[model samples]
Target: MSEVNAEIARFDLLVDAAWPAPGRAEDGGWVYRHAGGVTKRANSVLPLGERADLPEAVDRAERFYAGIGQPCVFSVGMGASPGLDDELGRRGYRLVDPTLVMTSPISGDEAAVGAAVEDRPSERWLRTWWSVDGGRHRDTGEGPARTWGERILGGVPAGYVLLEEGAVGRGVPQGRWLGIYCMAVEPHARRRGLGAAVLRTLLAWGWQCGADSAYLVVTEANGGARALYEREGFAVAGRYHYRVRS
Candidate 1:
C-alpha cells in the first residue's frame, strides 16, 4: 500500500476502536458488526485487507445481518478491499451517507469555554445527542436505541463533553490521535457558537491528554457542520460511505 493508503488504514483502525460494537464477528478481512441497529457505524461491515472468495464472504455477511433482522451494510472507505463496493452495488445495495473524515492538528491553544468534559456521558448529554441524531432511522427511538448507544459509548475509554448551552461531543484519544464523535447542538441552540465551543473544548481536552491530532466524520449533506469544521481548520482527510441492502 502507498503511504496515503496506509494512513487511511490507520485511521480506519482508530475509528473502529473508538466506536465499538458489542456484537462483532470476523469473516476473512471483513468485520461484521451489529449493535441493535442503533447507528450505521455500529451495524455496518468494515471490509479491510483482501478476501480470496469475495462472493462467499459477501453472502456470509448478508446472512449474518439477516440473522439479526437488520440490513447488510458495508462501510466502503479508502482502505476497503478493491472492487468490493462495486460488487455490493451490483448486488443491489444502495449507497448512503457519503461521509467525509475531517482531521486537524491539536495546537493546545483551544479554549475550553463553557463546555465541561466528563469521563462518561451524563443523562443530559445523551439526551441532547439523541434528540438531535436519533431520528436518523425509523427504529432508532430514544428508549431502546439509547440503551444500545450507551453500550457502544462505554465500549472504549473516552471523554464526553457537554456545553452548558445545549451542545454535546465525545473525544477518544488513541496514542497521538483523537477521534471526535457525537457532536450535536439542540435546535433552539443554533447560531449561538455553542457547537464550536463544544468542539474547541474537546480539542483542548484531547490536547491536554497528549493527542496531537483530531478526526471526525460528518455527512456531506450537513452543510452547517462542514462549515464549522472547516473554520476549525479540519480538512477532508478521507471519505467513506455505506452500501446497504434493503
Candidate 2:
C-alpha cells in the first residue's frame, strides 16, 4: 500500500487505541465494536479488507449489534473496497455523520489557558463532556453513556484535559502518535481562542509524552472546527462516513 493508503488502513487501530471498545468481535475482515451501545462509533463495523467473505462479515456484524439492541452501523473510509459503500447504500443504509480525520505534527507552543491533565476524569470533567455531547441530564443512570465515558476511556492510558472557563479535551498517546478525542468548548467560550488553547495544550502534552504527531476526528460539516484545526496546522489525512440501516 502507498503511504496514504497505509495510514487509512491503520486508522481504525489508532482510533481503537484512543477510544477503547469494551465489547468487540471480528468476522472475516471486519471489526465489530460496541461499548454498551453508548455511541454509534463504538457500535459500528469497520471493514478492513475487501474479500469474498464480506457478506458474511456484514451479516455477523448486524446480528452482533442487534443482539445488543443497537442499530448496525458501518464506518466507511478511503481504503475500503471500491463498491462497498455503494453496496451499503443499496441495502437501505442511509449515510450519516460524514467525518474527516485530521492530523498534524506536534508543536511546541504555549497554551492560552492552563489545562489540567489527569489520568482519570474528574466529576467536573465528565460532566462537561456529557453536557455538550449528551442530550440527557448528567445525572442519568450509569448506563451505556457512563460505560463509554468512564470504562472505555479509562481503559486506555489517557489524559483528560479540563481548561478553566474554556474547553475540555482528551488525549491518548501511544507509540509515536497521540490521538485527541472529545474536545468541546462551550458556546459562550467560542472565538476567545479557547479551542486553540485546548488543542495546543494536548499537543504540548503529546510532545512531553514523546509523541511526534497528533490526530483528531471531526464531523465534515463542522466548518468552525475544521477552520480552527486548520489554523493549528492540521490537515485532512482521511475521511469516513457512517452507514446506518434505515
Candidate 3:
C-alpha cells in the first residue's frame, strides 16, 4: 500500500478499536460517551486534515458540546488521519498541553522487559507531577471537570495496562492496540532513564496482559526520547492534532 493508504488504514484501525460510535461517544465530530464509559473525541469542528473550515467546525462543535453537556476532545498523533486541529484553532481552540500516543509491536522473539514497575510512587514524584500537569483541575470540582482524570481512568477498557504508581503517578498504557498517555518521570529524577524505564516496563506488562501491539501520541519530537523509542523499534505511524481554546 502507498504511504497515504497505509496511514489511513492505521487510523481506521485505531478508530474502530477505540472510537466505535456504537460502543459510546459518537456524535459525529462532537463528544460521545462510550458504553464502556470511555469518551470518544474526533475533530468535528473541521474537516479531516483541512484547516480551512476549522472556524465553523469549532463553532458547530462547541454548540453541540454545550447542548450535550460534554467536552470536545480530539485524538492526534503522527499518523495521517482526519482531525479538526485547525478549525478548533481559529474558533479559539488553544493548541495547548501534551499527550503521548505510543505503540509497541508484539512479537514472539522480542524480549519482554522485566524491570519492576513501581506500584507505589514517591510523594515527591507525585507532587512534582501534579505540579507540572494536574493544575486547577484538582481543585475545580466542577461538573465533568471534577472527574477529569477520574473519567479517563474509570473508562479504561478491560485489557489495558493501568498500573498506578501509588501516589506518584498513574500509568496510562497505549501500545499497538493500546496507547499510553500523560507519562511523568518527575523532576528530581529527570536526568535518569526512569520515564523510559517505566514505559518499557509498562510495554512489557502490556504484552503480558495480552495486548498484541501498542501506540501513543508524542508532540513535535524530543531527540533523546525519540531516539530511545526508535532504538526500542518504534516509528512514527501517523500524526493527528487539533486546535484547543482555553
Error of 1 at 205 (Å): 0.8
**Per-residue accuracy of model 1 over 1-246 as CA lDDT, tens digit each:** 799878976777788899998889988788998888888898899999877788888999989888878889999988898879889989999999999999999999998884568999999999999999887645443247778888999999999998867899999989999999999999999999888888999999999999999999999999999999999999999999999885
lDDT tens digits, residue span 114-207, model 3: 4444434344444555554565442332334323444443444522222233112234333435454445654555656555655666666666
Please give each candidate's TM-score.
Answer: 0.96, 0.90, 0.58
Number of the top candidate by lDDT? 1
What are the clash counts of all predictions, listed in order?
A: 0, 0, 45
lDDT tens digits by residue: candidate 2, 157-198: 888788768578898988889999988887777789877887
Clashing pairs in 2: none
Better of 1 and 2 by lDDT: 1
Q: Residue 1 deviation, candidate 2, in Å?
A: 4.3
**Candidate achieving higher TM-score, 1 or 3:** 1
Angstrom error of the Cα, residue 24, model 1: value is: 0.4
List runs of model 3 lying over 4 Å from the truth: 1-25, 28-59, 66-104, 108-132, 136-138, 141-146, 158-176, 221-224
Candidates in order have lDDT scores of 0.89, 0.79, 0.46
